[model samples]
Target: MVPSAIVTLAVLPLTPNGKLDRNALPAPELASTSGYAAPRGQTETILASIFADVLGLDRVGIHDDFFAIGGHSLLATQVVARAQQELNVQLALRALFEASTVAGLAARLNSSTEIKVSPLLPASRQQPLPLSHGQERLWFVEQLGLSNGGYNVSAAVRLTGKLDVDALSAALSEVVRRHESLRTRFAGRGDSAVQLIDPPWPVVLSPEAVATEDAARQRLVALMQQPFDLAQDRLLRVALLQLSPDMHVLALSIHHIVSDGWSMGVLVGEIETLYAAFCAGRPSPLPELPIQYADYAVWQRRWLEETALQRQLEYWTVQLAGAPGSIELATDRPRPAVPSFRGAVHRLTVDQACTA
Candidate 1:
């Protein structure tokens, strides 16, 4: 993969043995609100406010680049949802990505027809909640008894200084308390399945001692490869691997059904924020989320009923008309009925002239 951005450091972090402490290298700072341009109109003002709220910024300028200011596809979805709720304007997720700035997004909203969007609210706990459409596809694959480790979304970071383990544990617990998806479990309802939310509970940051860095890497990989029981176990996990007194690796793993790449980024940001606050013996600075994952799931099921469902089916029908049902690819062996979800690496060498 190509490098996204390079950060210049005065000096690289070195280990006790004077070797480069690769893990201690700081993450690149790609987002900056260097230039500020205030919003000029009501639509732009509202759009800017939504962006600021979703990104956890004090304020957002009309000309600010959303992606440059720590926005992603998942956050863009939130911005669109909030815009629909506030302005009664239907915004496509793709449209938000294309025209990410407040001024550009306001222009799109001004030209587009207004539509009604059902407000997402907490669903009743008396009844089981249905899975979101995206979650349903993952659940179906899980039902096939295939490899589940492929669905793990994981991240690792190295903490170089003395870490307050208790504060870290408290932060993880607070995060699980804040995000309902982490406390969720799936269960079968006749032929289909539903999600069940459990009350907030304590979380453990299991510690492991590794003799060498290689051993620590292996342990972290094993932790990530561990599968979850969708019907019983919690979907999120965290572990701390200690290589030395001041060097440790923090590992986190969550099921893809409850998280994705973009969501993982959001989770990391929130975790760091909470950890810093807890380390200082301060209360959580985060505000209560307007809606939880269960609310979104419930809203999705309701929105996809009747007209929306038929409209989607008809649109795809016309688009896929006369298309091949499947494509034939030459393989070393026939594909298995149930996917193994295994992958391998194949390396190739190309001439410079051919590349050119």
Candidate 2:
């Protein structure tokens, strides 16, 4: 198998002259991607090549999905632009969902199929209610940070057993109904922001499944590689992995807009509770959240504008002073004159003696 290359860049603070002052940035190491490879010769290949050119993917394949490869919503727009230029087809901003795979998307294009428009919530579900104070606050904070692109953050977990699809479905539904953030969407009000309420509950499960471990890994990898709708309010994704007859893993991802690490913990605890209850043949109702993510956004804006934030910024400036231009590393490709955060990961294990 051909080895894939990985890239990393140190982000620096800008000086008054507008040049990157690399000396002020932290030295982040380049991550590795030895086992991971992009799919080749599929519709994904065309898209991936475009993405690689724009985002600088060291290695990409046709079967590779965008999100699994660390593609975000900001990058999704870029992909759409490339598609328009290369394919000469008009794609809606949301086309990534129906035509996620290269083969899947290429088929759509070949057949001249129309892209379907999806609603914030499916019509079968109940309409969502208004946003709470907490949800409002979360939105404000995201806007302030200029990190309002992606709607969900996700992770993968391994599990053990033959998954009962019926039970898993019920548990997912319960989690969605219990959390308001899962159902909330943001509307732009002229120059301001508005939080539109909708019932966004219950996880949507894909019908596709693989029968073997290798096939399961390939499916999961492909799913992760594809980009999802992040500009929308609900940005959570979950995948179940059946590694063996008795071993399974769960991949949980949520958009940062509706959740933080703290909120994720809350979601996990609730999911566990609901899942256990379902397994026992009696599931209880989930208590309402004190507030939604939007409320936190509003609160964050107010907090950041206060004297406390001024002091915090001052501390950060001092703490990050005189760092370095960039972290030096051996790479598969020549370094770009300007650094970027094209990163990959490596796993390490230590022996007992090393631990000691």
Candidate 3:
């Protein structure tokens, strides 16, 4: 069933003051205590309770899909972590995709099953690492009591001709090895602070080809539909698409923790140069980046301490003065006490007539 049928909800973006307009939420629905073959009432009640507690939602129904109401990848990881701690159930990171609804997930839990966890990098590479500038920023925002929004930065490059998949993959691997940000991690510094460190890059490649235009479009849709994982690994991901025998596209999605808009340009430029060099059988000519994202994080901490943060705070305060109390967006139903980041996404395109 579609998510709307279960719990219709949308998250209203927070205003500068960082408060939600509770009145904008839709009313909660009552739990369906009958009809299904499963232990509907018990399962629903248990799952709803978990959802309410974990997501900070007021009420949750059994039929509601965790993600449909605006669940995010990182949040999904938290949910899994909580489940392991509270329910003593080990859940695969991918389980949320299949068991989106509370009832569905509870049923899966009821059914004894095993999920294989992916192996980590080599022992030599397994060490505490540092956080990226973006990660530091996220941590800083959270420390300031801001809602954890899914901060992401990415780039899309249009390919001119047919792409050599094997060559591109090799080039990507080389790029990963060269860039420390793509290979970095966050380590805890006493209290709530974190330090950034360089770690071995572990890259996973998934490639596919589309024979027709419709197929290519479908592939793109599916790619976007797939949620990014922010819990197990760094948030950076890449997808290379074979649109046709003569055209292709490269899409990169990275959590805001590692990079920003300027950083994206830097990454794309480096990748293009490296790919071209690899294709021509020449060494990559790109100059070394003086500092990786981690260095920037360290620098940011130092910089913010130099009275600059006060000025920034003053600027923002005045800029947002007298602004609306909250940025309210309509939702289909009442929000849960504990909010889940899961949500459905729809794509729209314009044709010649529609555009013109």
Candidate 4:
């Protein structure tokens, strides 16, 4: 797919050894304001400010295209989140993607019919909180012993130039402190499962030095492949690998139980913001979250108990009435009752002539 915008740079940034330094390249600038339309009303004004803040621009106009000005799907979620938090309105992520400009999104907000969703507030921890429906299924799979490294979501980012290890550690700890799910552990209360929120604690980074890039890659892969114990171990893992005096790699892994693709984007964004502030000897600028994952878990259980549950079940039941239980496919071996979660990569080369 084509990129949303293309930027022209005078020269490519290069590493000390003269290779392209991808991370050092600048993001595409905000769209030109020659045709800018000033925000007209309160709603549009608020939305414009949110767009600018999320895009890291000084100001955004009502007619400016979000994607044309360096916005992406990950940043779109942040925009929607900020709008919800500021406007106290429920919004679908698709709404922002479809109506990309401030004026268009404000019109959408005006036309929406849904009631304001009750805010997610922190609940008392004295009583055990029930596992979210999604977490319950994962807990079941863990109990069945079918879970493995398959659920681990791992990512690595290369850091160039002087690195601050202490600031990085403090940033990570602050993130864990903000998002309770990263520090949560699950347990069984009779036949039902519950989540326990651990008090925020310091997170220590595992530092290691590697002689070669290949060795660093191997070590990162091994660390990512390590399995997490839902009942015992913390759901997050982070390691810093030093490849050279001027270069390092930060490897991060989180269990799917506590994170997903979207959440990972948010996590990285927070760390980036926090790390910079700490390095500058400034306090964290991130605002405290109104609610934590544990609060969402409690809110979800309460909402599911209402009449909405029956309506949703009936709708889905009708939609899938005639669907088959399983699809039959030829296989080298019979499928086991429990999946081992082992996987392998297979590569196939396609001929250029096939397209022409």
Candidate 5:
């Protein structure tokens, strides 16, 4: 009459940055274990799939917390939209804020379900896909002025421990394959420039073998300094420097037009998941994304052109009317003749009490 199985639970631990620390949790005591647990019922199974698909996860356990594994506000909208479509039940977005797990969501489902939404400007799926409203604003600025070395975003991270180079390469390639915007480039100029989606190729991780850590650091600095030619290659590039067998630095660079601050996190998270899975000789832990950057672009143009232009313009016009065009930063040299996006970054740490 007594249960034989044992279940031990512990409080969740937080990383220095305040996110969940999966590694800090106890290792599964079982012989072998999967991070995901099986779903309990049909509704849980359906909800699991919705969560996995929306979050780019391979699987979801019934009790797994969504935000613990990188879910955010924008992706929450997706989960609500998808659950409405696939489950034939209307669930408020707040249901996620409240429950945030599969079982909780399934229990709270109520209200009449609306049919799936028609494509947001589905007709634009044809050739020469238009850029998103955000992209267009950047593109216009590029066209009018600032012809060179503008709007490039780059970052670097250090990797420790012996790495599997092949696995790392494969993981980077898969991330590029998964995100369409990474392989996309503008093919023409002026009003004619249209997005050209290139077929997936090896997102080259240009490797350099260095004699010492200092040498590797110098090469990394140079690689980050090198400017990108928008027409020459894909919008993203990566480099790996092997300072020694156990230490390396990864340099990842992307153009701002195709990528943004948010997309950066998505890229890094997917790569981490894929790399771990690859090193284990398993298949990628990422799901095929349901919608891509191209779809969002087409949708953005449609909404701005049809539904949002007047409202947005009115709001911004009154908000910024007669505002100063520029604020002068103390510069070391005189400014250039034409407007330029050429820039440098300065980071100053403020005291915690002052910041608060």
Candidate 6:
């Protein structure tokens, strides 16, 4: 049964400098044992098991809400996958969001329930494709003469233990083959750009030995700035820098036009999964993704004319009525005809006590 009451504690974590460290906030913990009611029957028992596993909890109650107890969209995908494997039923991601409780979702996901991904976009290689919303915005700004490197996103991870270069490379290849967006490039014809999903071009994951970790950091910065030909080459690149025999740093830089934070998370997660399987000498264990970025773009464009979207657009229009075109930030240099994107970064660590 659902807990009779939810204890809401208003607490936001802060760094030592007192600035709100929103990222440092911990996940919502399970309710105390006194308040939780375990699954009542077989259906709920199974569903509860899956929920607890995905949520990293020892136990879950039939009435406990998925999102209320630290669940998120990505973890929701894991729940759907687990359900498909164990229960032989397909649960839509939306279904989980709708039926948040175990009993509610269990009722919706019986034996007949099946999961489905959006259909692929019906476009040939020769035809032009529209960019995703994020890409669309970034592309427009880039055409305004912004530097391309401004859109580059990157992350570096350290590798320890037995680092298998061959398997790591193979794993990235498999990941690229699996996600069309990773293999995608943009070709501009006038203002509009066509997204081109390139055929398999494997990454070279060999690590170059750097004298020290500091040297690796310098190289990573250089790699991040390397200009990409969005009209021709792939938008993603990877490098493995060997700081020492036992320590390696993996760097991946992707153009923001074809990627976002969520996509990067999927990329890294899939790489880890594929690498593990490859190192073990097994085939790719990752299941086929139900939908890709292209499919989503197609779906968005098709549904743009719906009443729901119209209402949203109208609301936003009124909300932003007479909004200024741009904010005049204090700068030493005069504003150019177009943004030069001559940007700089400064780092500071604030004390949490002073911030809060």
In candidate 6, what residue range of length 10 has the lowest lDDT sum?
111-120
Q: Compare the candidates by lDDT and give the number of the best one.
A: 4
For every candidate in turn, the CA RMSD to the true structure comes to 12.4, 26.8, 25.3, 10.9, 12.7, 10.9
What C-alpha lDDT does candidate 5 achieve relative to the native structure? 0.74
Let me know the TM-score candidate 3 reaches against the reference structure: 0.47
Backbone clashes in model 6: 12
Report the lDDT tens digits of candidate 4 across residue range 191-252: 76888878898978766889999999999999898988887888888999999888999999
Candidate 1 stretches greater than 4 Å from native: 1-85, 89-115, 340-356
Candidate 2 lDDT over residue span 1-356, tens digit each? 32222345554488889998767765332232234445444455677577567556576555455555556677778888778767756566677666654555666766766332221222212333333345455556565543433334555556566666567777878777766567656665554455565674666554454587678777766655444443363556777766555677677766665677787777777777777788888856576666555555454544456424676688789998998869889899997654454669897899999899
Which candidate should be chosen as best, given TM-score against the real structure?
A: 1
What order do candidates take by TM-score, descending?
1, 4, 6, 5, 3, 2
Q: 1 or 6: which has the higher TM-score?
A: 1
- Candidate 5 at residue 88, lDDT? 52
Off by over 4 Å in 6: 1-127, 306-333, 338-356
- Taking the tens digit of each residue's C-alpha lDDT, what string does model 5 give over 296-332? 7776666566645776689899999999999989998
Compared with the true structure, all predictions reach lDDT values of 0.85, 0.60, 0.62, 0.85, 0.74, 0.78
TM-score for each of the candidates: 0.68, 0.44, 0.47, 0.64, 0.58, 0.61
Candidate 3: list runs displaced more than 4 Å. Answer: 1-134, 137-149, 158-160, 187-206, 211-231, 306-356
Stretches of candidate 4 above 4 Å error?
1-118, 319-327, 330-332, 338-356
Clash pairs, candidate 5, are none
How many clashes would you count in candidate 2? 57
> Backbone clashes per model, in order?
0, 57, 27, 0, 0, 12
Which candidate would rank higher by TM-score, 1 or 3? Answer: 1
